[model samples]
Target: MIRTLYIDEMNTLHVCDSPYDIEVTPKWLWVDMSEPTKEENLLLSQFFHFHPLSIEDATTVKQRPKYKEYDDYLFFVFHAIDLRTMKPEEIDIFINSTLIVTYHKEASEEVDKVWHTMLNKKPNEKVTTNEVMYKTLDAIVDNYFPFVYDLEDKVFSFEDRHSVDISTENLIDETFDLREDLLLIRRTVLPMRDLVYRLLEGKVLALSKKQKIFLHHINDHLIKQVEMIESSREMTADIRDNYISLNSFRMNNIMKILTIYSVIFMPLTLIAGIYGMNFDVMPELHWKYGYLAVWIVMIAITVGMIGYFRIKKWF
Candidate 1:
């Protein structure tokens, strides 16, 4: 669907269903296309005369976070993340001195919020394309905090031995999954950081002094996000290594016990083997007290070895 927000010279706000509904030249105009149909997509080329490449990029989803300078307007591609799935939703923006256009394949809470704020502005309160862009970008970046904070909390929980009650295998699996989520968030954040930094450089977009400050604030947020993600990823690695080491330690203890038992049985097995041999080794078998004597010797050997192992604390 296509929607338009137009502000007049008197600082009046007008919301329209289509661009054609705006009869007068707007001081500031914003057009939003959400899940646009093929016919609505053509508005970019036929009505607004956007470059075909820019149009294609806007229509397409999953474009990396970036911006391109055009002769008349600056084009930007940004990602709005789904916190639950850690998936990115693309929001494409076209902005000039007076007009801003936003396109997305799905509904955008960020866009909707700024859109409503613009609509509800008090009388004589002027809204500019720059303000709208900043607000939208701010909202997008702000949404990232909850997910990152949640990831950090989970990592902390993993580090606390008393907090995590699951098996080592399951804990490791969860840590790996958290790492993957951080990677996903990183992919979205790093490009966004670069995009905001470039915007701050002002080589393309001619930002005013105040605008630069606001954009710089957003850049700061992106930097904070990047740091948090990196720290969380490292924590996940530590958690995984700790669990693996614990598993190895447990396995070594088990193998030690099995080896001690094997050593204790080795001599007994040898004596039994000799006595079970045929005629040539059968002198003890014919002795009147031979069975009892052999039993005594075997018991003594077993007891003595056990005592030696206990003294050495081998168990």
Candidate 2:
């Protein structure tokens, strides 16, 4: 999908036609492309001087989050958090002086919301391309915080409910999944954090002082976000380790119980096996009172073993 927005006199208008031309001078142009066709790729290359490698990277799905500074434009590849599934989606951005282009593998609701907000501005309002970009980037980054907090809440809930009788497998798997999400977020956010730092340092010739300050603000937010993500990753790892230890302890306990039961039954099994053997010298077997005497002896032995086990607290 491709959507274009051309801003004139601060009133935003959507341009629908492919290869659309605007007669009025556009202070800024925003192009959003998701799974772009060959034609669209060619159009971007021709109009924006986008590097072939950058275009290739944009089309390739699930590339690691990174940034590439071209001679004419800056390319940013990052992940946008999907709130519904708590997964990360790839978002690529290419920015030049007059135009800003975004490439994505799938639709992003957060990106859409930022686009709408920018489009609704009234005429005569002064909006820079940088400001729009800032808002768009910030919106994407901001959405992750709530998702991170939600993950923390989930961990707390699990701890509260299952602290005593927790399923080790389930707890460990959940923690690992959370760790994976945080790792993904870290890969996506850290590079962009560095990119924002560069922008603030005035490395981009297209940025103004005001724009740099705005980028710094965005960068600060990203820094805090990165810290939070790192912390979450560590926390999940700790939780996973704790669950593993708990599982080991539980297994040892079950083994001990089984061992005690086997020990208590060993003598009884031996006695039964010895008396079952038939022999000519077995005088007790021939006596009528022998059966009652053996029964009394076996009962006494069983009761004695039970008392011993209880005193030892083996159960």
Candidate 3:
């Protein structure tokens, strides 16, 4: 999908399909493309003079988060977190004097919302492209908190439900999965955070006063997002440790029970072994009264052992 916006005035912006060009004032124009093809790439390169290396990275999926300063533009690659599954999708953004291009391997809900907000109004009622960019970045950052909060919630849920029946394997896997997602989010957010920080710090030459103010707003949002990601990562680590401790406790309890059972039965086993031995000269085997005496003795021994175990609190 490709969306092009040409902003001429505050309320009047033009929306067009991709693979097309128009000459407008040195105003803010934003173009977004997803899963571009060879023909689309060729068209963009012809019109924008985008660097070959930047185009290569844009075309390839799963590029790492980075920033490349070209002669006339800034190329940035970042990932958007998928809140439902805690995965990251790579997104590429390029900015020059009058044009901003965004490339993505998959659809971003935040991007789509920003695009619609830009195009829904008449040209005279549209917002500045810079402001639109701010909103786009803001939306992406805004989404991060919800995902991080959800991960935190999951960690707490796991900790609260710790039990012997719960499978440690699954819990550990989930903790690692949450941690991986937080790391991916951090990779994207941290660089973008730095970029916004530079803008807030007045380091970028491309931004005008109005654009800088808008970028500063985006910077604040990014800062919060990065903090949330970091906090969530820590929460996952804590949950993992809790799971380990719970499992160890359960194992120790099981071993204690088995050991106590073995100890309690040792004396009974010894007495039974002695009686079962075959000996023709055993005097008790031929006496009728002796059989009764042996039964009484066995009962007495069993009761004594039970009382001793009770007194020792071994149960």
Candidate 4:
């Protein structure tokens, strides 16, 4: 769907379905496109005379996070997490001195929010398209920090209270999940830092002094988040290695104990097997004391083997 927000020279705000509804050209106009149809996109080209390449890129809908400065306007692609499913959502923006256009395949709550906030300003207060772009960018950038910090918190918590039973399989599974989330975040945030930096060093719009300062701070925050994500990935790898080593040690100890028991029973099993032979003339079987003697021999052998193992410090 296509929607419009037009603020005229008298500092009045008009939300309209079409630009033709307004009698006078707006001083500041923002056209928002959501889940745009092919026909809707073609209308954009006719209305704005945007670079064909830019329009194609918008419709293709597989843009990476980037900022491209065109002859007449600046184009940017941003990624935000969808609140409902926690997946990446894209917002493409085009900004000129007096007009701003935003396109996305899905409805963005963030974009709607910035629009309302700006509309709430006093009616007599003048607004510019650059101001809208700055506000919208700020809103989208700010939206990221909460989710990043939450992920950071979860990672720290995982580090702090290490699970008691750190089985290798379970630890590996959990670490992989966390790593995947961080990777998603890193892909979006890192490019955003670069985009902000390029905007700061602009051939695009001449940012107001205030906007310049704001962009610098956003860039700083983004860089910090990238570092945090990198650290979290490293921590996951460490946890995985620790779990693997511990599990291997546990398995070795179990095997050692079983081997010791088997060794200790070897002679006893031989003695029992010899007496069980079905020879009618087995002399030792005929003696009543022979069973008692066999018990004493087996007990002595078991104790001796255990003592020898202890002296060698093999347990």
Candidate 5:
């Protein structure tokens, strides 16, 4: 579907299903194409004459977040995340002095919102393609916050559980899943942050001071998001390490106890082995008091070993 929003010379807002339906020269024009068909996609070449590479990138479903500056316009491959699944929704943008075109394979809530706001403008309010573009970008960035904060809260909760509940089931799996989610969010946010940085540093947009400020504010949000992602990633790593370390410590304690038992039993086993041997050299086997003497010897050995172990604190 293709929706067009344009402002006439009288600064009145108008909406049309097709850009060709608008007769007057618009002060600013916005063309939003949502899942356009092949014929509708031709508007890129027949109407706007965008570069083939930019058109291809725009039509494609998944492109990394980036912006390319052409001779007359700038093309951007932006992503809005699916908050429920943490997947990216690609939204391509083409912007020049008087026109802004948004092409997306899927319907965009952010785009719809900006479109609505443009349509419902105050009588005296002025709108431009740049302002519309900024609003869309801002809306996309704002959408990220809820997902980020939710992930952060989960990470915090998982960390707390890990601290107090050592036997919690699937702890490692949960940690890894959280890390994976953070990684996905980071993939979208990092490139977006770079794209915004490039927009701010370069003169491609010809933005007003206020617009630049607005973009800067978006950049700040992106920075905070990146920081949050990194911090969460670190927390997950710490959790994994702590879990492994705790298991190792428990294993060492178990091995220590087993070793102490083996040490105490070694002499008793040796004494029993000698008596079990039937040979001519076993003279004590026939003595009347031999069994008693053997019992006393074994008991003495056991008591002596226990005393030595206690002195050294081996147990």
Candidate 6:
């Protein structure tokens, strides 16, 4: 679907569902091509001097987060995350002086946000394409905040509740999952920060001073998000390490008790071995009370070793 919004020089708002129905004027314009068909792609290609590679990138799904500068326009592939599943969503944009176009495979709340803003925003005298582009990217970044905070909350909750009487295996599994999510979010955010940096340094779009400052502010926010994600990742790592260490400690205790049992039984087993040897000349074998005496000695050895272990607190 193609949706076009045109703001006249007087900042009048005009909304059109069909791009052909709306006539382009000499004013700042924002064109949104959502889940565009082949015809829509060709139409957008005609409207702007979009390089073939840029057009392909725009149409392509699952593109990595990146920014490409062309002779006439700046192209961006940005990723947003799903809070529920922690998957990445790609949003592609083409920005130039007079127009801005966004393409996505699925319907995006992020694009709708910018659309609503451009429609509802009261531009007093004039609105520039840079402003619209900034709004577009800014909305995408804004949507990221919720997912970031949700991830942080989950990590923090896991950290606080890890000591609860839950299954240690489950704890480890959850922490690993959270780490994967943090890594995924980081993958999206860091590149977006780089994209913003490239935008700030590049000559395309001709960002005005006001627009640059606005973008810088957004860039700073992205940096903070990256930091939060890193911190969450560390938390997950710490949880995993703690779980491993605890298991190792438990295993050591088990081995210690087993070793103590072996040490206590060695002498008793040796005594029994001597008595069990079949020799007709053995004096103990001939004694009538020899069997009773051997039983008594084994009993005493077992009791003595158990008492010793208790005293030493070997457990």
Q: Each candidate's TM vs. the true structure? A: 0.91, 0.74, 0.74, 0.83, 0.92, 0.88
* Better candidate number, 1 or 3, judged by TM-score: 1
| Candidate with better lDDT, 4 vs 6 | 4
Question: Per-residue lDDT tens digits of candidate 5, residues 1-315?
Answer: 999988888988888999999999998899999989999999999999999889888875468988888888989888898756779999999999899999988888999999888888987587777888889999999999998898889888985576677573489888888899999999999999999999999877788889989999999999999999898899889988888788888889899889888888899999999899879877898899999998999899889988998899977
RMSD of each: 2.2, 4.2, 4.4, 3.3, 2.0, 2.6
Which parts of model 2 have CA positions greater than 4 angstroms off? 1-20, 24-28, 120-126, 163-213, 226-251, 283-311
Write down the lDDT that model 1 would get: 0.89
Query: In candidate 2, what are the lDDT values of residues 1-315, reduced to their tens digit?
Result: 788887665566656544366677777788888667777777677876688989888876567666778887878777787777766788888887677888787788767887888777776576665666678778887887787677667666665756575467777777787777777667667877876676666556467667667777788888888877777777777777777887888899899888877776787788778789987798888898998897788788878877888898866
Assess the local accuracy of residue 91 in candidate 3 as a C-alpha lDDT between 0 and 100: 74
lDDT (tens digit, per residue) of candidate 3 on 1-315: 676877664435667776365455536778888767777777558888888988888886557666788998888776677767667777787876567888886788888988887767654553554565567777877777777677668766865666653678888888898788778667777877876676566555567777777777777778777777777777788888877888898899899778876765677678778778998888877887986887777778768877887898866
In model 4, pairs of residues that clash are none
Ranked candidates (lDDT, high to low): 1, 5, 4, 6, 2, 3
Please give the lDDT score for candidate 4.
0.82
- The Cα error of candidate 3 at residue 148, in Å, is 3.0
Give candidate 4's total backbone clashes. Answer: 0
Reference-based lDDT, each prediction: 0.89, 0.75, 0.74, 0.82, 0.89, 0.80
Q: Is candidate 3 or candidate 4 better by lDDT?
A: 4
Per-residue CA lDDT of model 6 for 1-315, tens digit only, reads 888887766667788876567665636667788878887778757867588888877776468878778887778888876556667788888877777788887788777876776677765656666776677678778778888898889877876687674688888888888888788778888988888888788775566778889999989889888888888888778879999899899899999989988988898899989988888899989899999998899889989989988998886
By summed lDDT, the worst window of 10 consecutive residues in model 5 runs over 160-169
- Could you tell which candidate, 1 or 4, scores higher by TM-score? 1
Best by TM-score: 5
- Model 2: per-residue Cα lDDT at residue 149: 74
